[model samples]
Target: MMMVQPKLTVVGAGPGDPDLITLKAINVLKEADVVLYDALVNSELLRYVNPNAEQIFVGKRRGCYRYQQEQINELIVERGYSKGHVVRLKGGDPFIFGRGAEEMEYATAKGMDVAVVPGISSSLAVPAYQNIPLTKRGSSESFWVITGTTKQHKLSEDIRLAAKSNATVVILMGMGKLSQIVELFQKEEKNELPVAIIQNGTTKKEKIGIGTVDTIENIVEEQQLSNPAIIILGEVVNHRNEILQVQRNINSKLTKSA
Candidate 1:
């Protein structure tokens, strides 16, 4: 009897770009015997999986029948021990608000080998795609990333100050609490500040809703924007329109030249 090789690789799918996936992650998927992926992951990346590999949807979507964390943990453990190679794919960096750490801890406790591959976080990438630089000398100096749906269900105290400070704020998984989150910033008289809510950032499905902190709640409501979105709040949000206009002008010039 031969001892089976127990290997578990948790890979980040990046921020909605199939091409952003790491070379190591692609190789892991290509060699994996089993791949468990999340809802945010682009399915196109799965094309690299071994033809005989088993692909499972373990995504946890809000208001949907999300696979329980415990169940997912067990699935990873079971599959990892049973298969020669198992890959747990997630959107964004595995350790950044991705629960990848939790999954890794559980599997490691069971004596399984685990490795993590970093991916681009939408919190940072989304704003970049929108041309809203998180930090500019005269604009912003720092940025904060917070999850809107935390156990406390309140913006982190650090983020509360960010609302008042010059730091740009990016909230992930926050669509459902959009109104409340905006109100949190408004309570301190930061309501007049610019903000942008981008859904499906970095993808063709991207949609941007812009308004002041005071008016964003209504704008988002009127737009019916949903989750899996990145909310940017601060002066950086004020630049979105101008940046987009600049991009359009550049495109028009290229078109005319062609």
Candidate 2:
């Protein structure tokens, strides 16, 4: 008897935009017998899955998690062998912010065949859609992307170093702890540095909150910006206002011509 090779395919659902999903990802979704998706994965993307596919919600929103990591890992292993094709769908690039590597390790341990399909990471696309360049030619050259949750919401070392560096600092899943994070940078000498928090980036529900390191916490409080968001800190953020102005000028010209 020829043994069926069990396989697990990890697919990124991209940012909030369903159109952003890759062709390869779509094909995998169609072939999948089961899809285990993240909380943040766009619902529209799921519509592309085969109608007969079994859908499972194994994602946690904010810190209010429903499924534990161990449980998710076990599900992938068990489902891969039991089901024809098990697709693990996550928001953004699965390997980047998502815990794709951890899941991959778990599946491999169980001798399941595994494959990864990369998608657009919100860390890069979210800022771009808002016209906030992560890196500018002379103004800024590099940017750092770090998770706000480190070993259960502890401060990441990268966050501390980013407070002093010239590079742009972008934090994912950091909205809930905005006060603590802002305090870290504000305590530094560059307390007056500009900051911008974009919530629901790249989506129609997107909102931008702007302020300085010294006052952003209060601004966020006033704005009530929530997560599934990205926080940007640096001189590069200042360019967003300029970009908006330029866009307005172009629009004005088009209006005048019309």
How many clashing pairs does model 2 include? Answer: 0
CA lDDT, every model vs. true structure: 0.85, 0.87
The candidate 1 region of ten consecutive residues with least summed lDDT is 153-162
Please give, for residues 72-123, the per-residue lDDT of candidate 2 as tens digits: 9998887877776799999999998688999998898899889999999999
Off by over 4 Å in 1: 152-155, 247-258
Candidate whose TM-score is highest: 2
What are the C-alpha RMSDs, in order, of all predicted structures? Answer: 2.4, 1.8
C-alpha displacement of 171 in model 1, angstroms?
A: 0.6
Candidate 2: list runs displaced more than 4 Å. 1-3, 253-258
Per-candidate clashes come to: 0, 0
